[model samples]
Target: MHVLVVDDEPALRQILSAAVGRGGYSVDEAAGVVEARAKLARGDVDVALCDIKMPDGSGIDLVRESRAANIDTAFIMVTAFASVETAVEALRAGAFDYIIKPVRNEEVLNRLAQIAALRGLRQENKALRRQVRERSPVYRFGSPGMLEVERLVRKVAPTTGTVLITGESGTGKGVIARLIHELSDRSERPFLSVNCAAIPEQLMESEFFGHTKGAFTGADRGRKGLLLEADGGALFLDEISELPLPMQTKLLNVIEDKGVRPVGSEQVRNVDVRIIVATNRVLPELVKEGRFREDLFFRLSMFQIEIPPLRERQADMRGLIRFLLLVHGNRNGTALDIDPEAEEVLLAYRWPGNVRELENVIQRACILAEDNYITVADLPSAIAAATSPRPVAGTSADAKSHLRDRLRNFEADILASAIEEAGGDRKLAAQALGISLSSLYRKLDEMGHA
Candidate 1:
């Protein structure tokens, strides 16, 4: 906690500031009411140990003005008068605790400790409420690129290293960030995820570094920004390239110094948070264009992981489709199935929107499906057009042959995709496809590929 010792007496101010500093808290001193008010107005002072009577003005008056301004600093009024009226006036003026003249260092330390505990509890409560939100299951990857990304995540999760994940939009960068947080020693701590592009440029600093109540217009109450709120945890900053130049410098400072000074505040507060940033845009290119800082890019790229787009990982497509189907089925309380033709269309699409688009497509299909069955007509027009021609309903022998050929070809593709995902290991492929080894071999043999 940061403490401000306010008193006109030079000796008392020095003595208290030294004592508070020795007690392991950052301490600043102000002489008289004007100086104290100036220091307090900054909103950095956590607790102000102020003298009741000063040459310029009364501490009670200062406290009343601070309260009216909504500055949330805790005030501990000190006075030599020791009268009930003085104590009552201090408390009414928003003083946290009162101290008589000739203060004992021990008593002051105790009061400060109490205030620290109260602050901890308030922060804890906020974190707890945030933790109550449900988390979705993280999908495991089968492609070599994703496997390597997973390996990096595991290797760095146990440490305090900052992570920079580069991927296309909707490619699950946020999911990777959460996986690292959940695997880390600080998993129990809060994990905050914020989209840099979503926040207004004007509010970026205040949102990231917190602000004192009344620090700006509409700031009715104090806020402990994302860094403080994610203390001892992880903060995922998605679309990091959207951060303004000024905020970028502040973020780099937090990375190097592990501290943040709130807007309108003069003092810095220590924070311990593991930052994980993600961006689709090439940061180095931005630096070349004079849009991003080179120093910040270097710092963030110290440990980087790039996620491959979904189109480049065809082997994982079938697995992802099945997983999404199962998830949506469980959520909507419906047993959903997709037609082979529809599944073929999905597998063939370029998926320009990546995993996020695939998920949306699946969800929409599930909702549109009749009798819990998703067919080609249920899919989006662009996706449905990606596949080969579908068989027409007919009783002719040629039509029967064409339909059988199409179904056989679809099955072969599914098996090939699964085998590819398993790295040509048939046993693993069979297990992934939930089929027996004998059945897999028999099918492969019948397909004349063995």
Candidate 2:
């Protein structure tokens, strides 16, 4: 690992640098915040030891700057006086650890090693989670609201009760259903998912329950249905509400009996498979209107989970964005940064399409971003348009308030436009706007767009 030592005392800096170098790392020395910032700009430093007091600026400023840049560099604050308030402030500013000024070489080395180990574990866990997510056929969620969904998944995954997942189109209801199956004891068994909406009413039964060789016009040969294929595992019925009334009745019987009757076969085939249903529409409303079977609705909704829209949990947007960028970056062999201005625009706009939309946006931005950073101009035109505000009909109390509102909107629009233009290259966009990247990121985070 490469370490940077920032201190006003040249002698102290040399001592710290020598100790860190002896601990198996390259060392860089900085006189103060200005020099530290310059070294950071050059990049590749993994950790920094900064003195609390400096001639130009406090070390807290350096800590804050490092965090804002989204740098993974760990920080250790060194102070002559370790007061409660100073330590608290240093930690709050994002320092990894704090040490007294008369730090022993052994103590410093030990803390550095600990931080390295912890950071390694965190990276490993992240990689493992990413692997699991990618391997799962259906299991997609990167929003805070989905945390509840995950909890419920864990609770019901081991159970035999039927599960009904409800969410908007493209909101990943299918993914949740698959996760439940994968988490269950029958994970090794065959898992099949059928989209009820895609099958025609005439073929729904045959598709789900199978048909005999001479059952229908197209039943020239015997074939196994999804339920039979999913024996000992899970059968996921997506868009369950789209199933016709007759099919719904047949499904209800199959679930209750744990067996299947082929279209023309007299033989009854017993199968033990977990059933999971997902729909975007409300089944209760359908049942009340006599469009769906009430008994079937009751049977399928034994375990119900409602996935909320992305707008409700905007706090997770940044984490999700970061995750997606890493995903795409790994795939394309490129790294990307999110411009603060563009991030603000993203957070401000209500995502009607939810997580799916956010993923799509990020994917596009990744492709479009020419530089290391993703700016607002890289966003889709629709998002840019939505984020830009127009003049309100009502008047404000004062010109300042009116100007403030207008300026806010104007800033949002500029950020959005810049990101769109930069193809979501935040660093490049920040440079274009003539502001420090850290400042841009901070501004965007404050606007809830990061």
Candidate 3:
């Protein structure tokens, strides 16, 4: 691994460079942020040790800038006891790690060693994905819900318009995202996905926008963020509603302007990439509750597609099972068979976690099956308890809950159709529905929408 040591103090810079060299890594030293930026622009450095305070500017600024520039280098901030608060700020801006000074050789060496090992695995995964991007996945495509999903994918995938896929978790949102990318003119380019909820709030901005080297505390190298990486193809932002309010504004600016400036960099780069985002949450409700941006919601919803939950499309279960079985079987080096009783149990279960949960169950069953046949014994406890061929008649309490769910779906569909017919004029929709505008507003509120 190549490492950069940036500190105003020449003695500390020399000490750190020698220590990293002894650890069997090439090392470079930068006296300040300006010198660090020059080294980072080359993009070969893998990690950097940056001081929080420097002559040119604060290290925090450098960290933010490096990430904005899309340099994939990791940064370790070197801070004094009095600068702990500033160190905290740097951590929020995307410093990989921070050390309190006077920095010791052992601590710095150990941290770099761990980062190098983890970075190796990350790079391997990226390379593997790139090598196989041409071999697209094949879907069984039997369920009406899934068929509609496929149809919608093909319908919108060919266009470069932004898309927002809304569905319950595990309904194959990622699969659909990839399908969109594959069908587009930019298919041969790159497809990148970022899970908004999975990233730390502090680092979200730097992750999306490339940063310049020495922009902040630990930023010793420049970075090209996800936006630039997906320049010629599609970028999927899953769980996008989880993005913080401040970042939401920045994202909206990018979507509207088609230009991005890295976290601390003054340069704006025009990018050409399709945006496909997904979320399981009810965004309208979130907007009403003041958690999501309303204008941004409208921008992303230009081509919206919602994938139905697994329970709603049980008709496709058989084909899904057969395909998943063959897949897991080949993977496990076994030809697996499911007994009639086991199939009954799978059919009866609600599958609250959708296709993803089903895949896990099937993989587990494949491992647990005896003599190549999977039985109820191999199923999860909840699913195993469900064996009746008929839908188990529920009690009065359950009936009310079930009826309420159906009514809600029915109402939402009616409202949506009416609004669409009126060309999205809610007042006209209300008149067409033979209801007062106030009544329509009340219904919308009750239905958890604006």
Candidate 4:
């Protein structure tokens, strides 16, 4: 906690500052109401010990002003005489508590302790609410690609390295980001996730680095911003490629310096945040095109993890389908089941939209299911039609072709689709197909596509 000692008398201010410092909190001094207001406007002080009567203005009025401006600092008024009316008036003006003058060190410490306890409770309540909101358990992967991803996550979670997760959209980058935070030493701190593409261009700096009160026309109150909120924890920046070049430079500075200067504030606050950025766009390509800063890209990509698209993780399909069914069923208070044929169709279909698309399909199937059973008919026509098995041709040429020949052609088609889905990265395609890179190359040569 950061405490502000606000009083006109130099001796009293020194006494209060010493008392607060002894309680193990960072202390700042303000000589009068104007100075206190200026310090509080920075939005860093957690508590203010203010004298009720000051030469320039009353602390009661300051409390009312801070409250009206939505500043979160808790005020503890100090009065020379403990009159009932004055105490009541301070409380009414939004002073958290009052301390009689000739303040005992123990009394001041006790009040500070109480305020700290309340703040802790509020933080706990926030954490509890987040836990309640996240109802789905993390899904374990069975595919080789996803297994490698899991290993990377485990390895990086224990360290403080900045992580960059790259993959196609909807490939669970956000999920992996959260998993890293959960597995980290700072799990109890915070895990703030935001989409870079979603933030407005003009407000990017203000939103990421925070701003003081009246920093802009609409910024009536100060903000702690995402970086400060995620101090001592991980911040997941999804769709990070969307950040403008200027913001990218600022982000790079924050990463390198471990400090952030809020909008319109000259003071730079130190922060300890583990940045985890994700993007479907190729950042290196953007750097080459001069759309992204090379320094920022290099900094973020020091430890990169790629999440394979759902089509690449065919081994995880059945488990994912079952998990989604269970999740949606439990959510809607229904006991849902999928027909064998329906499951086969789902397993064969290439989910271009990845896990997110699969979840939507499952949720829709659940809603359209009859007798709590999902069948082939419940699936979308496109998926069902695309994966429907075709009959063998009756032509003489087809019949003359050996079964091995037909199987080889089918395998070639599968390999080609996997390559396309893997964004033409043959190694990734080979990994997805559970084959060696050399074998993938050999197979392509055999099929005359080398």
TM-scores vs. true structure, each candidate: 0.71, 0.57, 0.60, 0.75
Give candidates' CA RMSD values in order: 11.3, 28.3, 19.8, 12.3
lDDT of 2 at 143: 59
C-alpha lDDT of candidate 3 relative to the true structure: 0.80
| Order by TM-score, highest first | 4, 1, 3, 2
> lDDT per prediction?
0.85, 0.77, 0.80, 0.84
lDDT (Cα, 0-100) at 82 in candidate 4: 84
Model 4: per-residue Cα lDDT over 1-450, one tens digit each: 668899999999898889888887768899999988888887767789999998999999999999987889999999897899999999999999998989999999999999977775665466557756863578988999999999999999999999999999889998899889889897877777899988999999988988877788987777878887676677889999999999998999999988877787765666788999999999989999999999999999999999988988989999999999988865457679998867877887788899999999999998777667775546776776566343357877676654435545777899999999999999999899776687678668766899
When 1 and 3 are scored with TM-score, the better candidate is: 1
On TM-score, who's better, 1 or 2? 1
Error at 343, model 3, angstroms: 0.8
lDDT of 1 by residue, 180-289 (tens): 98899988777888999999999999999988757899876667789977877789999999999999999999999988888777677778899999999999899999
For candidate 4, the per-residue lDDT at 162 reads 96
lDDT of 3 by residue, 1-450 (tens): 568899999999999999988986767789999998887775656788999889898888888987888767799999885566776788899999989888889999999988966764564457348647534356667778788888888899888899999999998888888888878887767678779999998888888986766667887766767886666567899999899999999989988988777766654666667999999999999999999999999999999999999999877888888888887866457678897757866887888899889999999998766567775546766664443334226666444443234434666798889999999999999899776677577667766887
Candidate 2 residues 1-450, lDDT tens each? 457899999999999999988886667789999988866644345689999999999899888987886665788999998799999999999988999969899999999889766754554454346446555233345556788889999999999899999988767787788788779887656567778889988887888877655577865555557776566667889888888988888888888987677677554566677999998898889988999999999998888999887777766777777777887645457678887867766877778887788888988988766556776656775786676443455664333243234545677888778878889999988888876687678668746799
For this target, which candidate reaches the highest lDDT against the unseen true structure? 1
Order the numbered candidates by lDDT, best leading: 1, 4, 3, 2
Best by the TM-score measure: 4
Model 2 residue 419 CA deviation in Å:
19
